[model samples]
Structures are given as structure tokens and as C-alpha cells.
Target chain A: MSGRPIFTRPARLAAIVPYVWMLLLFLVPFGFVLKISLSQSALSQPPYLPTFAIAMDDAAWRAALGLLSVDSFRLLLTDNLYVLSYLRSLVVALVSTALLLAIGYPIAYGMARLPLRWQPVAMMLVIVPFWTSFLIRIYAWITILQHDGLLNQVLLALRIVAEPVVWLSTDSAMYLGMIYSYLPFMILPLYATLSKMDPALLEAANDLGASPRRAFWSITLPLSLPGVAAGWLLCFIPITGEFVIPDLLAGSESSMIGQTLWLEFFTNKDWPVASAIAIVLLLVLLTPLAIYNRLQRRQLEAR
Target chain B: MRANRLSPFNIICLTLGAAFLYLPIVILVIYSFNASRLVTVWGGWSLRWYQDLFNDSAMLAAAWMSLRVGVASATLATLLGTLAAVALARGEGFRGRGAFSGMLYAPLVMPEVITGLSLLLLFVAVNAERGFWTVTAAHTTLTMCFVAVAVQSRLSALDRGLEEAAMDLGCTPTRAFIAVTLTLIWPAIAAGWMLAFTLSLDDVVIASFATGPGSATLPIRIYSEVRLGVKPQINAVCTLIIALITVLIVTASLVSKLSRARGESAAPL
Candidate 1:
């Protein structure tokens, strides 16, 4: 298999290069974060205790051995603020993902049902907005939702409300921002899967006296589950740690874990606590990631 | 089945969806030329904000840095990603392939906050001074995964027989790869590079953590000011960036369409 030793050896080496780079820069960094999570915060410049050194000092050794007081983690579990923020972030992400699905499925299905000549145009329309800067898009929402913003102006002129309803700093506004920003992420994959389906399947169901809605449910919905799952995962994971949306639209009262982590590091200057929160965040996401991997393996095997 | 028609319900959904996506951007772009300082007011059209944006030194510096960082990191990401994709797609079987694949995909799905915080800690642990390089390193790690996925899909869909045929014609393995395979995947590689560059340009959170003093990207700059309230100047800059991006995307689509018309075999990216 390797008669050409010159070519085989170098090609193998080239492959190994990226693996080593990822191991050093990607994998090893997580190890540092985990190590810092186990230590204590310091007032010194680098900010963390014994500076992630394990075998150097007795205190460092104790910290490395998990002998340090689990105070940071304890604070995380006991503090209602921290606990609620975690839960709220999860809830927001889940609800937003569901909203995206609800809003995006119809658009995707419409695109998929279009004639071949028109499908690409619909797909491009979905992607064009995504090319804009995310921060700018969120900023646009601020202008649209503020007290004297366009929405309020239009509503007042139309006699929808006597006074401008505050839409910028509310949970509903946050939900709107999330759905606006992430809808493309949800729609693209669903479009990918739905567009690939053979039209005859739906035609057969319709020919057999099933209404369009029933055919969609019985034939199309079940088939699009994989795309929905992928889009759901893509949206949920990033939205859970979403910083810009909540910071700009929802404000500080909305306690997403990402904001919480930022506060711990910058405002509180508690690097250890921030690291602890990060560790917990990673731990929380592990199950779903593993499950995703398992499903992917199964799909590959089925193929 | 062949004559599938979009019902009225589907048409409405599509129209509303398109409007929702485009309206904010349209408003933002239009307001950049507003003469009034107020964000929402329809001031008479003026180019004052665009003039101010051009003269702002801090913004000029941040834009330059962001451009340089995006280009440098995207180039690094594209090279590393291509190598990884080649291994994954071209290699028949390799040890630790599963774990390697998982490592590559983890960054794709991982939270940005966690990634930023983790990389910051790594820099501190290594006593590496956080600066331009630190941001570039973090970006390379973040974007390489995307490039790898793009290139890998292209490589997998490629005709495997071409490389074998080249090898059979007394060409060495590496020669076959360079002469046959690399040329075919060049388009995907270019697409991946542009994707990575834009991602680096648009990034804020990761740049916030991984960067040290004097490394604020354009997003960071805009975000800090946006908190005070929206300004016309910010809208001006946003329009310019969007314009640049539009040019890039239009060029990309035209290239792909032209290549397709020429009967080239590259997959749609």
C-alpha cells in the first residue's frame, strides 16, 4: 500500500500536522480552563492562584487535587441569581429554537415547493441578510424597538396604542431579536433536506385522497426530522450562550449565562468563578453533543 | 408532482419572511444618509455621517486591524483546514480518526463564550501576552473548523478515480494530489477562505476575550457605542461594510454560475 515511501511519509506527516495544531491550540486550551476552574482567584496580575501550577507548591497541589473548597461551584448552585440565570438562558434558547422552527418551516417548505427556476432566488433571499454584520443587525433592532422608534411611531399614527409600549428591554424583544438573527440558520438546513425529497411521495399521498395538510404531516414532516434536529441543535447551542442579543435588547435584567460569565470576569474580576461557570457550561452541553455524535454515526452506518 | 404550485398560504409566508429579513437592513442603510442626529427621524438626505466615518481615526485604525487580522487568520485557517480535509476525505483509514473528527466539529457547535474564555485562560496559562497574535490564533482555531468542513465536502464528492489514474501514469502520490486533486478543489478552498475572512470580521465575543490592549475590532467598537444609542455614523459604516460584502457575494455567485455554465464539476458550496 505504501510502495512510494517518499510520498506516503510526507502525506502522513502533513495530515498529522493539523491534528497536532488542534491538540495544542484547541484541546489544550480547554484543559487550562478546566484547571483554572479548580483554582482560586487572586489579586495579582494574571488573576488566578498558584497560577494553574499543580506540582509547584503544597497549596497548588491541594488545589489541583480537588481539595480546594468547592466555594465557586457552591456559589453557582446556592446563589439564586446564578442558578436562575442558567435556567433562564436554557429556557430562552429552547423557546427561541422552537420559535425559529415555527417561523422557518413554512418559509423553507415554500421554497422547497417552488419550481426549480425559482428555488435558487428564494434561497439567496434567505442568505443575503445573513451576510450583514450581526452587531449591526442587532443595532437595527434597537432603532426599531426604542420608545420613539419606527414601530411606536407607526402604531401611534394608526391608533394602535395611545403611548409607545416599551419594546426594547423586554423578554419579547429579546425573543424577537433571537428569531431575527437565527432564522436563517434554522431555515437553511430544513431547506436542504426538504428540497431533496422526491415530489412523487407527496403526489402519491395527494392522489390517494389525502388533503395537502395531511400529506404534509404524514409524508413531509416526518421526513424532515433530521433537518429540523440539525437546525434546532445549531440554533439552541449558540443561542444559549448568546451575548450580544441579550446585552443589547434584553439588558442586564435578562440573566443569560454568557452575560453572567462576562460579569464574573470583568465586573467582579472573579476569574475563578468565571472559569467554574465555563466548566459547568461545557459539562451541561456534553450530553447533547455526545447524542448528536451518536446519531451521526448511526446515520453514516445506515448509509 | 411535476407541476407543483405554491398555494396562497405559502406565498404569504414567503413574502412576510422576506420582508422581516430585509426591512431592518433597508432601514439601517437608508438612515445612514439622514441629516438629523436622531436615529428614527427621517432627516433630509446628507452625506455628513459618511464623511465623519472616513475622518474618525479610531475607527480607521480598528478597520485596518480587523482587515489585516481577517486576512492573516483566514489564510492560516484555509491552509490548515485543507490539510485536515485532505486527511479526512482522502485517507482510506487512519488511527484516531473518530476523535480527530470530533475535535474538529466541537468548535462548530460550542458556545462562543466558552471558546473565548477557554482561549483566554490558555493564553494566561502559557504566559503568552495577549495581543494581535492572540486574537489571530483564537480566530484561526474558530474558523479552521468551518473551512475544513467546506473543503472536506468538496473533496468527498470529487471523483476518486482521477487521483488513481494519475498515479497509474507513473506520477507519485504527492504529485498526483498537487496536479489533479488540488486544482479541482481550489474553488471550494477560495470559498472557504472568504467565509472564514467574513467570520473573523464579524466576530466580537471571541475578540473581546482573546484580545488585549488596543485590539478592539470594528464590532467591538460599534457595540460599545451602540450601547449609548444608535448613531448615524455607525449606520454609515454598517452600510459600507454591507456594500463590500454584497460585492464579494455577487462576485462569488457569478464565478460559481459561470463555472457551472462551463460544465465544470465543482459542487455548489
Candidate 2:
């Protein structure tokens, strides 16, 4: 083993740079955010003045800690608008993930079962949508969903509606935009996992007199849980902080946590409040992510 | 099962999925030729929007800026990522390797808003003026992780024997790597560069935060335009971008496949 190639001293030192860079650049800023979240909001001055003990006493330190109490949490909870937005973001993410799963599963399964030569072609088609600007893709939904847009034009031509429907600035339109944007994310992972499954198991199930639906539910679906989890996590986590879809499709009336955070940071210039909001958002978003990681580890262990 | 036989279900799925993915693009392309200002109107076909898009200096400038930044960022990212991938793949059991990999993966999983906001704060704290440099820095930071992962996968799948054999033939380690490992993994590095370029081109949220007025990217410009209101010229731009990407993807895939086939034929049996 000693005679074999291993990491050279220089190579190991080089490897340490990226981690140090990440810690200084990525992790430190996050730490700063957490620190700011715990500090008192400098409403009277700049957003983060870093208050000190007025009398240089222990009571001042205690008071500073007291000021940073769960007031932000209380404010976030009591504000029905913020609470509603949080819930709405979750619902949108969940619904979008489900819709993507529904649409992506059949397409992925079909792609996986296709002739080997055509599989790459199918994958290319799925990934081509990603090549364009993401904002442009969301903007494409605006063209399709706006009043007197292409969808309405077709519907009117078909005599399905006497007038154009107001689809944009609605939650349904937001949902459609998000699912359309993220469907490829769902499909790719599902396709990757499903394609790796043993074909013999499916054949064995079929040979044992299981119908197509039964075979899919019993064998294919269970095995593809990891893919489902991965796809769901990919779609759900990002959509929680989605600003563009809600902004374009649902308008300000359906403002999401991301939009709110954007406004707080940029428009209001309230750094402490924004930091507090961001900290809470991080917690809310990371809970599911942590849970997903735990589940993935368990799944691996079980295997 | 016969090779040529196709299931009806598979056929339907393929058709529907392709249609769903491509219809918006087709619509955008077709409507770029619409004579009327209203994109929904079925007016006589013309190339007015494309002409308008070309004549618009701001759009051209934004596109140029995006191209410059994208190329710069992708180049930097590919280099950094290649080094990191080598470390992660070939430096097995090295000190702090797991932590390095985790850090590499963190940005990919983190929400863009968090990344953008965090970077914005960092830039502010450091007194670094937000502009082209900041935007390029932000893009490189995110794109490097993607490049690393792509290159690492290729490196992991590579046969170690070729490099070992080359080294055994009295070549220096670095020389053997260049002659064997690098030649074999060049395709992956190229793929990672293309992926990074595309990602940089598509970035908006982070670019919005880091970009100054003079360094607005095409996506940032397009985003501001959409926020104001959609215009047919935007469709013309989207159409051009889609066409460019399709050409690139086809070219890259064909070239990579040919190179791999050649490599397989030349490999020692």
C-alpha cells in the first residue's frame, strides 16, 4: 500500500485551501448573520451598530440579552401575514413537488424503459429547458397565463371560453410556473435512479403473474423511494425561497418569504430585521433538510 | 424484447414530455416573427422583434457583459474545480478531505437567495464595490462546486491502471498524470466548463445582488424588463439563446462521444 500512489504532501495542502476558503467566505458570513440576528436592532442608527454596555455593568449585558429575546419569533408568529406567507410557501412547494412527481414519474419511467439509443435523446429533451434563462422560463409562463395570452387565445379559438381568463396574479398560475420550472429537476434524478434498477426484478414480478400496475406499485415504486426523496428535496427546498415565480405569476398579493426578505433587506434597509427574518427562514428551511439527511443516512444503513 | 419495437405508453410519454418542454420555446421562436406588438395576436409574420432586439444597444451591451463574465467565471471555476476534484478523488483518506467535500457540496444545496444575500453582506463588509468583479466572484464560487462534482464523477470512474503503468515506465508523477489521467479526463473537464458557462449565463438573483449598474448581465436585464412588463423583444432574445444552447449541447455531446470512442480504441487491452 505504501508503494501505491497516495496523496502527496503538496496535494494535501492544496486540498486544504478550498475548505479554508469556504469556511472564511461561506461559513463566516453565515455566522455573522446569526450574530446579527441575536443583536439589538439599531432602529435609531444604522441597522447594526453593535450596542455595548451603557454603564459598563453586568445589568447592561443582561439587558442586551433580554432585548434579543424571542421578540422576533413573537412578531413573526403574531403577524398573520408573515405566518400566512410561510404556510403558503410550504403549500406551494409541497403541491409543486407533488405535481412534478406526477408528471415526472411517468416520463422518467418511460425514458428508463426506452431503447438505449433513444434514452440520451429523451434526456436531452428534458434538459434542454434548463439551457435558457430560468427567469425567462418563468416569464414564458407569463405569456401563457396572462389575460389574452396564448392559452386564452387558443381557448377562445376553440370556443371553450367567451372571454380571456385571468390566470396570472393567481396562486394556480404560480403553482404552474413553479412546477414547470422544476419538473426537470424531478425527472433527472428519478430517471437516474429508475434507470439503475435491476430489470430482472421487474421481469420476475411480471413472470409471477403481477399486473403492470401491481408490479409498478410493489417493486418499482418502493425501490425508487430514494429518488423520490431526492427529487422532492431538490424541488421543495429551493421553492421555499423562490422569489421570481411568486413575483411574476402571483404578484405582490401572494408575496413569499423570499420576496419579503428581499424587500426587508433592499427596500427597507433594515439589516437586523432582515437578519432575524433570514435566521428564521434558515431554521424553517433546514428542518426538512436535516430530516431528509437523517432519513437518507438511515436508508443507506438499512441497505 | 425486439429492439425496434416501441411501447405505446413510452411513445405517448416521449411525445408529451417533449412537447411540454419545447412548446414554450417554439412559441417564443415563432412569435419573434410576429408583425404586431402584441405577442398573442396572429398577425402576418415578420422579423421585426429580432430586428428590434439587435438594434437595442442596451440588450447588446448586457449580452456582451454576460458573455465576458460567463467566460471569465467559467474559466476560473474549471481550474479551481479540477484541482479540487483531483484532491477529492485521488487524495483518499487525506486529512480534512470529507470536510472539503462537504463544503464543496454546500453551495450547491444552499438556496440562491441565501448565497446572494450572504455574499452581498460579505462584499459590503469588505468594502469591495459591487460590480463585474463581485458578480464574477459570486458566479465562480457557485459554479466551482458544480464543476468539481462533474469532474470528480469522471475521475472516480477512470481506470487507475493507466496512470500507474505510465508512472512505472519511468515518467515523473506529474508527467504521467498529464499524459494519462489528464488526457482521459479532459472530456469531463470540458463538460464541466460548458456546464459552468451555462450556469453563469443563466444566473439572475446572485447577479442582481452583486452586479453594479455598469455591469448588468443579460439575465439581470431581462429580469428587470419582465418585472416592468413583458415585451415581444424578450421572446426574440430567448429564442436566440435557446438556439445557441441547442447547438452547443449537440456539438459537445458529439465531440465527447467521438473522443471517448477513440480513447477506447487506443487503450491497452
Q: What is the iRMSD of the candidate numbered 2?
A: 3.1
lDDT of 1 by residue, B1-269 (tens): 23258899889999999999999989889989899999789879999999999899999888988898899999999999998887777654568878777878778878899999989988887888887899999999989989988898887777777777778998888889898888777878888888888889899999999998887888888888898887889999999988988887888788767755654543332
- Model 2: per-residue lDDT, tens digit, B221-258? 89889887768999889878777777877777988999
Error of 2 at B243 (Å): 3.1
Report the C-alpha lDDT of model 1 over A1-303, residue by residue, as the tens digit.
223344444555667878988998889888888777767888888876655454478766655566445678988999898889889989999999999999999999888888888888999999877777788888888889999999999999999999999998889999999999999999998998899888889889988999988998998999999989988988888898888899889956658999999999978999989989988988888887776666554443332
For model 1, which pairs clash? Answer: none
In the order shown, the candidates' DockQ scores are 0.57, 0.44
Off by over 4 Å in 2: A1-3, A7-11, A39-47, A51-74, A291-303, B1-6
Least lDDT summed over 10 consecutive residues: which range in candidate 2 chain B? B1-10
- How far off is residue A212 in model 1, in Å? 1.8
